[model samples]
Target chain A: MIGSEEVERETNPHSIVSVENLVKSYGGREETVRAIDGVSLTVEAGSIVGLLGPNGAGKTTLIKSILGLITPTSGSISVGGVDVVENPNRAHAKMAAVLEGARSTYWRLTIRENLEFFGRLNGEVGTEERKRHRQFLERLNLTEKMDDVVNDLSRGEKQRVSLATAMARDIDVLFLDEPTLGLDVEGSFELQQTLTELAAQRGVTILVSSHDLGMIESVCDRGIVLDDGEIVADDAIENLLDVLQTRVYELIVEGGVAASTRNEIERAYDVVSWVEHRGCTKLTVAVSNANRIHGLTGALVRNGLQIRSIRMDDTDFEAVFASLVYDRPHVDESRAARGER
Target chain B: MIRGRRGRLSSSVSILRALVTRNILIMKRYPLNTAGAIIGLYALFLLVYLGGRSLLGPGFSGTLGALIVGFFLFIMGNASYKTLAGLFATEAKWGTLERLYLLPVKFSHVAVLLSISSLLVTFFIGFTMLALMLLTTGTSISLDLVSILPIVTFTLLSTIGLGLLFGGATIRYKNISSIFGLVKFVFVAFIVAGPTFEEVFALKFLPLVQGSYLLQRVMNEELRLWDLEPLELSVLVLVGLGYFTFGYVLFRYFTERARTAGVMGHY
Candidate 1:
């Protein structure tokens, strides 16, 4: 049993979405697979929540169940106040989503037409609502591609159009799964910026799942890390970083040491992971403890290694993710089950 | 706040409408199939007309008109089935169904929408064949708006129901593709060689033959429908209603199962 304070700490503001003891299985004949097992979480309203999991970690399954796209074997999910399993239509009314691709819209229809279709489907498409649709398109930087068919637009442009369609729905809850997948750097940054603004300005309860840890960190307020179909770490971004903290440092050498000397210095640190690029051995040393750096560098000095500069790398976010998912034999258990099936 | 039966109904309708519109747009992108269907239907009508002329000679005129109309209905029904199944199988193959499953709307709505959108393909063909037949043959098939309207409405409803049923089945069972194809083949074959089979079986429950019988009634202007056996019309209505109910139940079942199994996005 989870305490109320723990739940509150996990879900700041107000928990608008609650999922309890969710389980999902597939292909029940001679071989059945459990995709999700006993997953539970709370997502607060007006806060961007990141549901982070590796591929086949039941991330998509969990998201679909929350949206009432699937039923749970045993458990309950509610969007707003409506139970998703019992009252899917009511639950869906409060939410919208952008999956990997833009199937929510028509392929042949122009972007504006797609928006009109979805908006009208949501009863928001009217002569009076076209302006609002246009505003959303513009906000998503999709106005330029508004008249283009989805198949005609670039991947990023199509993604923008997809985002615009969900935005046109203007629902209270938004589910974004790998929203930045298959996007270029500029497009990814642009999308991240748009999401940040949308959540901050519109008070939309957004749930995002993505492999791009950086993007999730930048756009989300809190994140839930899932492994083996269970919530392992649920915390705010700052707290997650704090929990997963590891020592990473940027090291600069005055002059290039011999490969052998560099190897010895590398042996001195726990791990020397860097490359010699642009006339600099930009090494990242992983120290067991902060005090170990003195002896670590002393070994380098004794080995005639000139250390021109060294700076600590921010290890909060990366360390948090690593700690949550890395070296955990149980995480491998999930992978093994998936592979077997 | 909008918690009630009416709210859910409206939401279902809204989602269905969205899915249908999306499918219609997909059809628009590749109008080749729609155009091919219209042309193929007209050709099929021509063959049926010629077959009737040869089989029953001048005495076949009234029956030929009815046959033509019946052929159109069967084609419409068959076409509806093909369109729905193809949409599902192809979309699943192309990995689009996963994206659809991720949406908040029910999968049943998507199935219904697929059926609705598919109607455009058959309707276009059905109307085209009707126009062409009227222009060429002009064999009075009774232009009574009253009888034609009800029959058209019922026929469309029945076709949509079957289409939904087939689409729903395909969501879980991939073999449903072949099932739909086999269904279309059997119906088309039955229409071509219905008379001999009707005589041999003497079964009144068959839709294809009954459809032909209704068309025959329409062409002869015997207009004795209200006075005729009530059970016949009731059977058709019951069959259609049965199909619709079965489709709804199956669709809801598989949708719920898919959701829980996490196979909703397995496609």
Candidate 2:
């Protein structure tokens, strides 16, 4: 049963997918696995949301529950304002999913047959719909291979066909699980471009789950990071990156500093690693803010240490992801340093 | 706005047509396998009859016509009985069951569509077997088309219901092929031995007994549509509808259980 709050949220016209307090456990008493634990999220319409998680982080379980493929232990998932648990068929009518593996299509059929069959199943079998399906094929660069058997196509081609079949349907929400698992660099880029275009042009709400952080960082507007079946962070990609970034500097100093000055420097910054080489000190310092680099240099100069060279560490999506999931205390240095007591 | 009854009905029909067409296209790809199965079953039956002719003597001629009709009905009944379960197993193996369930339509609708398509192919095979039997055995059939149609339809309904019941079991158990094989063996034994026995009241409750009896009478005893008593027709109709409804409900129940267990794609 959905709570009044969830019921109210379901009516949000901008929200295409809403999941509240979803809990799913599998297996018997002694051997059960709690796949999802009190996870809640909302995917707005016409936006691409990236579901990022490590293995066994309940990404697939969450996606399946939202798609109405698996029943949750206790929770409510509303897709396009329809409760998927109570009226799965009705809810499924407004959505389509391409699972991680190519298990969504018939391998024995040709590409065109697979698209046409799924289109018919989704009630998109009109002449105009068929033309649209062909246009999709052409846009995906699969027109020449339309007649080829799906089993005969390469894995990348098969993945494209799966995407085409899902896109061929006029659904409000599209769920893609690991859409670029085995694609080459070029294929992955092409798929990312297509998804971006599809969401923008067709106003389709997409929830994509993938380990390709670069792709997720490039294509997604929002990121929902899950760790151990709990949401660790949910925000816009840029904001998440901003909040999760840890500014670290690697420095080489020509003159050795006194023990008191080193202690003061350590008190001001997180000295990740320090070593001495050839009468010089090398220090890796993590600061709360990038501007604190000037303070660190000033403190060092006050101790009469000659600063040779310093470089800020390059931060990417991978770094942000690692910092969030690993619970690295890069974000809250004051609290972390005090907690060490 | 909610979809009206007519709209839902048309959508179901459209999905059914698509499923049937898909199955037909797949069947077309394996034409030789299809033809081989039909011819192979018929040839086995022909060889058995020829090899065992010595045991019957002259009495065989009197019952040859009945035997031929009974064999045809048996083959058709067995094929229909196994179609649903076999299709379910194949779909699970192919990883297509979950995909079908993901559609807006109910899973039972897909089962029914597959059953109907299987029946069409079975009928085609039955006719081929009948043709071969006529050519080799030099036997003439007295087919009461009007009477046979209703009886065969009812009997197929009941058999299909059993098939669906087994198909549902397959979904839950995943490795019930051996059980299906055993159940099918029992059904075959009943089909062969069913009409040979007298019309005991208990025999009517068996899967194909009552309908096969009526069908045999139509072929050998020249029973017409009106010749059947009202009670007999009522019994056939009740059994047909009863089994179909029971099987559909049972299949739906098992499918729901499988869904909750999250094993729809586990086979």
Candidate 3:
């Protein structure tokens, strides 16, 4: 986790978007449901941040609140240094979004009309001004389908059109929710490239939420994982791996693990996956401490289970994400999970 | 300070033009729907004109001028009542409602712009239906823009206000088209209320009913808006502004509730 000093710096002049102590609650006073509970974070300019979470994790709610699509019960959200609640129109002028539902464009309007209409809505009416938006279509490989109505396009094409529509205007910050949901490999890659270029070349900050963990790891500069309406993990991509500190190992044993032995293993190790055959058992377990490796093997041998092979498996961001969100005991969640130190 | 906020008039005009163009293009794409609506409206008017004339017999002193003016105002009311509410409900289903809030203007601005767009098109259709009625019934009426425009404006404003109330509710409630049957009954009452009923103060206050009565005065008596009593004009203007302002406020309130409740994108 970053120090408090880093958070202070991050929330300074360089921060284009800042959300503070946001809380959105539902239901009567007798029963309360908070969609986002005191979730705070700052997105610096020209950075790509991935919002990762399981279903019903308040990712969409957070994004919506930041975009001023939904009002938080109590909090402050600012975009480009403008308070969203006090002056949403000004905040919207500096922002754009491809929300969760990929139906932002008029289904009957052609791609050309969608681009033109959105451009004009954002005050980019001139031919020269609109021509500047062509790069979005080109990057999404949708320029050739300019005359096609959104209803006629394939699912991937429709999503790209939505992306192009969101990115068609001059915007400093862009919010996308599950943008890669319906995209194929090529479309996903092109979208990633577009995001990278927007951040690297234009200094446009992006906050995207998607279930595709691999894509988030590959493209995003930082990752934020939310669970149960709170931000449980927020850090750089590499730092997330470093902070997880858990090792995934594969243990192949001769003769299957009896129910009693399996129960013991479950009690000790964080088993990621388990498989058993006629005379073999393959167990993929996550061990937090290095000393637990020998301990596990010694216990297995003591239980009359012969260890055929033991090796460390590959580790990815998913493990780190799972550790933080699943409330694993090894990490000090209060100190490590909250990236604001 | 909105970064690209223009002088009031210029930005309003730009957004209105864009919205009008969008509505026009979408309407053009569905020629069948437009043709079907025109035919259905024409047929309904034909039913009223022919059936009323036959039912009352010759010397049925129901002047075509009043009928035409009343029809025009009714059409205006119908447009005002349905356009905003229907557009919003459809936008919710299309999942485009929340996206409009992303635009660099207030959602109310877009709502007003959309109402204006639909009003302009409704005017076109109103005239077309009038032409058809004139041709079919072999009737004549004065078409004075000077006398008719003010009444039409007030009537449209009142109906749009009523529509905004529903439009706002639809964002949160999702499906409320069941109330349309009641609106149809109200239209019938507006047409059938007699001169005796006009004596009642409350009857005179019915939305678009008041405008219809004022309009008939112009078409049948050859009067202009200027010749109308100050009390008459004042009451109409007051009702129009009052209903519209109330509806607009309700719509804004419902919109905020929708945002808070998180149902804007749900159909």
How far residue A85's Cα lies from its native spot in candidate 3, in Å, is: 1.5
**Can you give the lDDT of residue A321 in candidate 3?**
76
lDDT of prediction 2: 0.81
**lDDT (10s digit) by residue, model 2, range A1-341:** 11113323344668878888898888888897778888877788999999998787889889888877788899899988899999888887888888844656788889999988888776648889989999999888999999998999888888899889887778888889999988999889989998998899999889999999999999999998887677777878887778744688999999576789889988888999888889999999987788888989999988888999999887788888877776635425634665842
Candidate 2 chain B lowest-lDDT run of ten: B190-199
DockQ of each: 0.45, 0.47, 0.57
Write the residue-wise lDDT of candidate 3 on B1-267 in tens digits.
233435545667877877888878987998777778889988888887878888877744456666776776677678767877788988877767777888778887778787888888888778788788778877767678888888778867888888888898888787888885478568657745623356877876667767777777777787888999998888789878988898889988998898889776667
lDDT of 3 at B242: 86
The reply for model 1, stretches above 4 Å from the true place, is: A1-13, A26-33, A249-285, A295-320, A332-341, B1-33, B48-63, B89-121, B155-158, B189-202, B222-227
Distance (Å) between predicted and true CA of B7, model 3? 2.4
Docking quality level of the chain pair in candidate 3 = medium
In angstroms, the error of model 3 at B44 is 1.6
What TM-score would candidate 1 get against the native? 0.83
Tell me the whole-model lDDT of each prediction, alpha carbons only: 0.70, 0.81, 0.80
What are the clashing pairs of model 1?
A25-B261, A70-B259, A71-B259, A71-B260, A244-A319, A244-A320
**Which CAPRI quality tier does the interface of model 1 achieve?**
acceptable
Estimated TM-score for each candidate: 0.83, 0.88, 0.88
